[model samples]
Target: MKQNYIYIILFISFIFVTLYIYSSEIKEPLEDYDETKNPKLVFNGHWSGLFCNINRLVNFLVLYPNTREIDFNVLASKTHHKPFIGENIEIFSKLFQKYKEDIPIDTTYNYDGLDFTKFDLTHRKAYEYYNENRYKLEPYNKAFNKYLHLLPHLQERLDKMVNEMRSDCQQVIGVFVRSNALADEQPTGIMPTREEYLEAISKLDTFSKKTKYFLRIDNEEDYEFYKSKLSPIYETNIKRAKSNKGDAPHASGEYLSLEDLENTYLEIALLSHCDILVHCVSNMASAALYMNMNLVSICVSKPAAQ
Candidate 1:
């Protein structure tokens, strides 16, 4: 029995040694890829926020291909599935308490509100307090970092669009018009009248006798309304983007639904294509400044209501 026990002990020690050697041989140091080394393409919309959660996820899968270390949870809160500045976080806090997970970090950014003394300051302060208390949304930082990694690529996308527009028009003047007409909602600020739009174009035409303008808006209704108002002013030189519907509206009152694809991406692309951007108090106009660095930015102030 003693001899048998000794032999068994020796066999176990040999097995351990063999397993350690095999493990050492199989292990390799992980390599980190610098995402910023290449250009990036940002895909987002108004509801998507600065870091488009879904679009970025897709981009990661397509761009990284083999990267497995990229963990989305490490960056964003589980509540991010339905993100709102202050409202959703409250719901998340309640859920977190029930689950007893590690406390989340606060990640509140800046905001500009129309009212401060009233309910506005209360809302802003709540967000600030939340930022002070919660786990910071680390994903935004990662997303922004990845965005910087592909800045050159995004710049290239911008450059390509610029070159194409320049070739199409003798001179390209980007026209950004307000788009609050959703469900008959009025846009804030002093919107340019038809005459004003024509006057602006007339002034631009002086730069090039055959100057053409690129107009971007949310809905086809606004596009047609503006086009009809401007055609007599710019004549046949006027080129509005063809409606994806493959048919034109019969009159000013006609409405057309926009493509269901992300509105934020369309807004960003439209703003990027502009040489000069005109915007109102709409959220897209508010956030446009952050996304498009090269455009000449202009904000039309909202008119006071009676």
Candidate 2:
């Protein structure tokens, strides 16, 4: 067993060496697509979940277009789990390290006046248009996905979750359901009913020809609720990450260690790998798109006051 582990380590090391050599020797340049010609995008703003922050980063980059390097160290994660800043920096740094060779990523963090959040846009309509449906536009989605990729660590974690589902032939479908508690916080401002989500899932299953489902629920009640509802038809499951059950764990006053936070992201990483995803239009929902996964986003808002 120890010898096997050693061999695995050596194989991984060899693969990295081969990749670095391959990247270095490639002198052929695509002048049109060269980022060195473009101005760099310095990222620093609302660091939410994996999806939210990533979506914003992708949106901003797409809107701007010309960029040589992306500065992300200052863009801290705004997780409910952590109280102060710098908690999730390690994970972000890891992501930067894993993708730096491809995108020339800069891992230095800074919060001076240079923060992207401080930079306000005068044209709201133009900004919103490019940011919302930005990826679908020319050269945005294709370019972003090319540079952004999850590290092998996250990929291995996602693979473990998929294997745990133990589906023999059932196709995996991901369902992203937000809770009533987060209704006001959601971009859409309205929580889809259990029935509405079920309908969406049924349609997704039919559309994708999938038999298994992984319902990624934020609240505990919803987890049990969907498990019961989905079990009757498709092979359904949820990520059993710590604090994944019941109410708002972040607001629970518990200090979410770096490890716990990584577990939380592991769930998102797993969801990103699903065969098909039915999601609400939010940052968490948008994060999956960078992985080149299929997405169906549902957005419904509460009626405005008269």
Best prediction by lDDT: 2
Model 1 agreement with the true structure over 1-306: per-residue lDDT tens digits: 999999999999999999876554323111223443322222222122322333333323333333323222312122322332223222212111111113332321111111011221121121221111212223323433333322344445445655666664554455555432321212332344445555655554335444556666544656777666543221222223344232322112232222212232344554545555544333343223333444544433323354
List, residue by residue over 144-165, the lDDT tens digit for candidate 2: 6755655677667667776875
Candidate 2 lDDT at 142 equals 61
lDDT, model 1: 0.36
- Candidate 2 TM-score over all chains jointly: 0.62
The true-versus-predicted C-alpha distance at residue 154 of model 2, in Å, is: 2.3
Q: Relative to the unseen true structure, what is the C-alpha lDDT of residue 132 in candidate 1, on a scale of 0 to 100? A: 19
Local distance difference test, per candidate? 0.36, 0.51
List where candidate 1 sits over 4 angstroms from the true fold. Answer: 1-162, 168-171, 181-196, 199-206, 229-267, 302-306
Model 2 misplacement above 4 A: 1-41, 47-50, 64-66, 74-91, 98-140, 163-166, 185-188, 204-210, 232-247, 296-306
Clashing pairs in 2: 47-78, 73-109, 74-109, 220-246
What's the distance in Å from true for residue 159, model 1?
A: 6.3
